[model samples]
Target: MQTVKNFSDAELITAIKTGTNIDNAVGFIYRSYYRMLENFVLTNSGNEMDAEDIIQEVLVVFIDIVQTQRYRNEASVRSFLYTLTRNLWISELRKRNSDSKRNGFFEASREKEEEDVSDFLIYKEAQVLIVELFERMGEKCKQILTLFYYENLSMKEILKQTSYENEQVLRNRKYKCLKELTDIIQQSPTIINNVKSALQRSK
Candidate 1:
């Protein structure tokens, strides 16, 4: 029987990027990271099926990251994959909670912390209106964007606050939140005008 070759981060990434023994590269990742990643999901309010799904999804994304030249060598491939897996599972938790509470979560969140996360975009009546829009999102997003726009923290700082395992993971979360917020603002004429008016006043 043949065996999957062990690869250092550099070697594995090179193989993936250069299309050398791509199958073996994948096999190495599965053998190396699947149990670790799957354990993360299993311990984090997920079932076996959920763990399997998350690990599979993480591998696909990790491979895509390599293929696209987006893999940064700052962290080991294992560490990066673990961070990716953990972040993804965290996101999946948010998603599952949001889905389960879709009917009332927004209103409930508002009731819990309507006054908190104030000065969300920046302090002002206009920003208050903006804050209201942010309130419609999930709690994780609210925390992430607030740290980003309000506290003006770097990704590393935000990771410390949010417990994100990697800067890239936090960056990805922030991007999605911003995109969602942008979509919401675009759909609202009142918010669009208020944002413009606020900028005009600030300038």
Candidate 2:
């Protein structure tokens, strides 16, 4: 196990591959890349939890690739990690936009420099989708879902905040709202395809 001060990317990868435990590698990956990955995801309209999940997923992918002998190290580990993160985020944004029926939000033009325009566009589009999706949901349903998922609030906290009559009521409403969102996602072909591709890639 490599500590924070001495851990390098190679050492971390080795720990991930052969070590009985990989906490050290996980910590090294988090310490080294968390900030950059967080900035990239948050800049692209994801919240804190989204950034956390994506970064963790990136590490999972790195380990998977290494174990499968698919990581050739053609590029620096940092470059490969960044590219994977970028692609995943782009796929997520595409799903969100397609789910919301907002196709023209992203421009097709390319810039000479590696501009972060797509990040900004994704955030903007996400905000729009969030608003539209919540609007489609009733106020009570929207508030319940947002508190539970987005704010990470407990159901007890939500009941107190929203003055829901009981736990059963809150749970029922949350389930229905989530079902609606799931149905909406299922109806979107692009989102369904992206979900399928993501699952396949993971396997």
Candidate 3:
């Protein structure tokens, strides 16, 4: 069996709050709480990958909590970590469940009054279709469109995030992606009708 090192709760909290020996603190967390978190996720419909991702995010949230003075000794560090893991896993599960439920909602919702601008079905359908379209696109196209349209990242900022050789190439790629996406939307009568209906309702 491999030996895992441990850190006292107070010592760990102090290191994170003061931003000192942070790497060691993170390592300690992985070494100590990893199995407990992994088991919790495994039993909760989460896979190994999910466990890994949750562990990474939990550490980030934990550090933030400690640094922001949210850790006021109200709970033991182990308990806090366990709580964070449970909440995060539950949130992930909810998002998955909602996505499953959304398909039914989208299909059933068209019967509602289109004149109501706030009709949940039409708006949600449009948004969901946009996501579906993006998923069908190439990775670079999806990235460019997402950064520009959704994230509102500037060309220069996107350049930093992407491996494009220059701004012109990046912009050109974005344009092509946009054009492709637009063509797709136009080809889909269902998407087009829903979007137009939503727009008309809003106007």
Clashes of each: 0, 0, 0
Between which residue pairs do clashes occur in model 2?
none
Q: How accurate locally, in lDDT, is each candidate?
A: 0.64, 0.59, 0.66
Task: By TM-score, rank the candidates, best first.
Answer: 3, 1, 2
lDDT of 1 by residue, 56-150 (tens): 65665566456544465766777777766665554555544445523432333332122322222124324566578779888999988676555
**Global lDDT for candidate 2?**
0.59
Compared to the true structure, candidate 3 yields what TM-score? 0.48
TM-score of each: 0.48, 0.47, 0.48
Please provide, for model 3 over 1-203, each residue's C-alpha lDDT reduced to its tens digit, 9 standing for 90 to 100: 95655689998998877768877888988888899999988987778867876676567656645653446576677777776776656555644554553344334433222223123223433465567778978998988767754665656789999999987677566656765765566567776666556555644
Which pairs of residues collide in model 1? none
Residue 161 of model 2 has an lDDT of 89
Worst 10 residues of 3 by lDDT: 111-120
